[model samples]
Target: MKINWAEDLRERVHDLAESLGNLFVEGFHYLALFAIGGITAWASVMAFLGMVEKGHISVDDILLLFIYLELGAMVGIYFKTNHMPVRFLIYVAITALTRLLISDVSHHNGPGMGVIYVSAAILLLALSILVVRYASSQFPSEVSAKPRTRRHLVIAQNRAEGDPGES
Candidate 1:
């Protein structure tokens, strides 16, 4: 069998271009994540302080803080795992929608707009959860599937080699 060097070279060049494009896109995503994270962290801190100063750290304010915490955690998770959990974003959206509904309940003239909005938010959250559940059921997390430590790998290798006594 003869290997086509020219075809292989062309394929390699195409692969390199695709990889570079992906890298550029990922870099932009990271930058956007950091920017949004910084802004949310600052806003959360300020809002928390404002609530404290006003002596009104209500349930809604606490929920807002939870949203902020989730946002920060989402950012941290992105940095650690290079992937953001859609679940967190859905939670944030649900909280935001709830907060809006609560704050505007008194002034809303419509009959079921608040209910509709809240229901929509709940539906979105449920859909996100379902998608994540389905994806994970199909492709479980690496943490559950494989040992991440070198020591664990060494132990497994020793066990495979028939060294039962090695602790």
Candidate 2:
């Protein structure tokens, strides 16, 4: 195969562009985190004011507040740990679905769609939790099963040494 310098240069340029694009995507992820934080804070404050003005906080409003709180917590955890909890996202989705159901049930029409939507959301939450649980169990945070302590190792060695004689 004849080496084409021009083609090689074109490929290198393409790779550089791709690398820059990936960097931009990561930057946007951080930007989204900030945007989410701002929006959640604003919504929480507005909800609090609405509660004060109404003199009564409905259950739906309380649920919405919880969703916002979960969102804020998720964002905070991401900021601190550089990762968000899937469980928290599932909880938020479930709570939002419940809030929607509560808000819609009292209306005279189309409760079926609300019920179906809520049911789907609950199913998705359940599946997500199951997946996370399975993944955590399969691939635990601890990389090894070995004990790190010299004392434990000595004890295990002694136990192994004595096993043949005892048997």
Candidate 3:
């Protein structure tokens, strides 16, 4: 038997490099998630404190907090599952647009065409959310699906025992 030292060494080197690269990428992902989570938490707390200091909480303040809550939830989900939830983003956008509309109405004497435009945008976002949810339910991603059990061991055992039709 002939042993190829250079080929074996190359394969080992390739595996090591691949492992290091994966490790670095995973580490960066974790670090970035932690930073994002921390910043979101800090900002949320600051906003809450500011509202408290003002001694009055408005609908806008509550909506802002809800936005922060959604962001925090999004970050946590991404950190755990490594998948982004598009619905959460849509929810945030809807809340933000509502806030903008309310702000505009309260500041101005009357609602303008801008209110209609914002409302339309919110409606579109809502429809997109429904479509996304329906599509996800109809055709789930393979990566998100539960892993199927392997039958290789049972098949191999059946073959070794000379059992016909077991496999």
Candidate 4:
């Protein structure tokens, strides 16, 4: 059997192009993550310096640091698992809202419309996080917690294995 030169060349070029594209995408992903890590570190350091200069750690400072911490954790999670969990974003939102509410109530003479709105936002974020957790446990598209994602997937597909939805 004679190998077709044109077909062989076409297949080789296609494979090379695909591999090059993958390498470029991976490189860009790492570059973005590196920038994010650097920015997060810089912000954390600035916040720490501010706290030190003030000689007292306030709720606002603590909340800012928490947001920075969550951002760093998010970047790390993406770098490690290649999946960004929505729960972390919700957590950050809740923290930021709480920080806003604290600042508004403390700085103002009384609670205003902003306080009510921020409180509502925070409550909604908390509820969202709970709903996501429940859904993840119940529906379980992937076995992600403890047992293993593959096992969870199998369990979800097999009813005799004790379905989470049934229980």
Q: Report the number of the highest-lDDT candidate.
A: 3
Task: Give each model a TM-score.
Answer: 0.60, 0.60, 0.82, 0.78
Q: In candidate 1, how many clashes are counted?
A: 0
| Pick by TM-score: 2 or 3, better one | 3
Model 2, 44-130: lDDT tens digits are 999999999999989898998999899999999987666668889889988988887878885645667658867887898889899
- Computed on alpha carbons, the lDDT of every model, listed in order, comes to 0.79, 0.81, 0.87, 0.84
Which runs in model 1 stand beyond 4 Å of their true positions?
1-29, 106-113, 140-167
Please, what are the lDDT tens digits per residue for candidate 1 over residues 19-80? 67878988998899889899989999899899989987777788789889989999989877
Best TM-score among the predictions, by candidate number: 3
Candidate 3 TM-score to native:
0.82
Model 4 stretches astray by more than 4 angstroms:
1-3, 141-167
lDDT per residue, candidate 3, 17-117, as tens digits?
Answer: 76678789889999999999999999999999999999999999999999999999999999878889999999999999999988888889697899999
Pairs of colliding residues, candidate 1: none
* Two-way lDDT contest, 3 vs 4, winner: 3
* lDDT (Cα, 0-100) at 150 in candidate 1: 41
Put down candidate 4 lDDT per residue, 1-167, tens digits, no spaces. 25698876876687677667878988999999999999999989998998999999989999999999999999999999777789999999999888888888888869778888888888888999999999988997763544333333555777765555422
Candidate 3: segments with Cα more than 4 A from true spot: 1-3, 144-167
lDDT of model 3, residue 1: 19
> Residue 30: error of model 3 in Å?
0.8
